[model samples]
Target: MKKTIIISLLSAAMMTSCFTTGDPRDGGIFWSPSKADARIGQLNQTNNEAMHQKQKAENRNKRLKAEKVRELNTY
Candidate 1:
């Protein structure tokens, strides 16, 4: 009976240890950030790059229009 009780206690301890606190895989109640934060950051970076590209395109268009006007006036 004593050996059985000791074995039960050891098995319980092992199981509890395996389920460890603060482990996301075990579905613990820890409040940690998820992968959404990284995804949002990546999205923001992509947005900024797109905005910069758009601005560059607009500036190029303006320069080309100004050059065309100057050439027409000279001709």
Candidate 2:
């Protein structure tokens, strides 16, 4: 009986130690902040890159339009 009680206590401790606390999708409670922050940073970087590309395209279009106007004036 004593041995059984000791084994039970040890098993319970092991189970609780490995138990998750929060939502699994959010990376639970232990590593939530690091994982969430990394995901957010990745999304922000992707958005910034997309915005940079769009700005470059717009600038190119404007420059092309100005060149076309100059050509027309010369003609």
Candidate 3:
């Protein structure tokens, strides 16, 4: 009986805590299209930047490999 009451109170507290706090930027209970679009744009920009970096690295690796092959052939 005592344990049950304690458990119930704990569960209620946990539930209330979950409800009361969080990033409001995530739209939470008040979402807008503008906010959503802004978030999407930020994500797209990040993805594009990452992809560009990756491509540059790949190109550099390819160039290095070609140089190595040419050096080996000349040796």
Q: Which ten residues in a row have the lowest lDDT in candidate 1?
A: 17-26
* lDDT over C-alpha atoms for residue 31 of model 1: 33
After superposition, which runs of candidate 1 have C-alpha atoms over 4 Å from their true positions?
1-32
Q: TM-score each candidate.
A: 0.56, 0.56, 0.61
lDDT of 3: 0.78
Using lDDT as the measure, name the better of candidate 1 and candidate 3: 3
Q: After superposition, how far is residue 20 of candidate 2 from its true place, in Å?
A: 9.5
lDDT of candidate 2 over 6-71, digit per residue (tens):
999998888677634334564443555566667778889999999999999999999999999999
Q: List model 1 lDDT by residue over 1-75, tens digit each.
A: 999999999988776655323334546543335544665678799999999999999999999999999999998
Clash pairs (backbone) in predicted model 1 = none
What's the CA RMSD for each of the models? 7.4, 5.0, 8.8
- Could you give the candidate ranking by TM-score, starting with the highest? 3, 1, 2
Who wins the lDDT comparison?
Answer: 2
**Which one wins on TM-score?**
3
- Candidate 2 yields a Cα-based lDDT of 0.79
